[model samples]
Target: MAIYMDEIVKQMLQLSCKLEHTVLNSDSEPEEWVLLLDERQYLMKQLDEGILAGEVLSDHQKMLLAQIHGIDQRLQPIMLERKQGVEKKLREIQRSKTAVDAYHEAGPSAYGAFFDSKK
Candidate 1:
């Protein structure tokens, strides 16, 4: 049980390091971020299961968890910023689409129209 716990913590640590690298060194591509996040979620689930099973973490494991938490703190703001940007872009696209649909519904305008002599 201790060995299994150790392995899980080590893998989590490695993933956190990779996430930190990705956050710092690249453009933070959404696809890559999603994949990493999915993996992290899975590891977290496993960690939770281990804890529920009464597995106690050693000091080293606790330190690794702390390091992961620190990395997460560094990554959170950047991720939120990126998410907001994406959402804003999506809203803009939706608005443009709505305008286009309304225009289509309105149909084409007359080529020419008579002007009123008196207003």
Candidate 2:
């Protein structure tokens, strides 16, 4: 049982390290981002399942905790970048909508007198 626990902890640690690497080296490609998020979600689900299963891991508790912290550290920057990207996209969409509305407001059907020469 002890050896099995150690192997499980080792595998979990490896996965955490891999996840951190993936997050740190992420690129601008959309598919890469999707892959990163998918990996994160999968890891999180697996961890949750393990916790729910009441498995007791005593040997590498501190090390696993540290790696989990490291993973969280990597998560912060990615989340911040995502927030900034979404905000920027929202600003762009708002700008586009505003321009369209302004054009419509100044169109010929606008609520105003028709074009007339002040001769």
In terms of TM-score, the best-performing candidate is 1
Clashes of each: 0, 0
Which ranges of candidate 1 are over 4 A from the true structure? 108-119
Tens-place lDDT per residue, model 1, 56-84, is 99999999999999999999998888889
Model 2 off-target regions past 4 Å? 1-15, 29-34, 37-40, 104-119
Positional deviation of residue 22's Cα in model 2 after best superposition, in angstroms = 3.8
TM-score: model 1 vs. ground truth: 0.80
What TM-score does candidate 2 get on C-alpha atoms?
0.54
- lDDT of each model, Cα atoms only? 0.85, 0.65
- Each candidate's TM vs. the true structure? 0.80, 0.54
Residue 72: error of model 2 in Å?
1.3
Root-mean-square deviation of candidate 1: 4.5
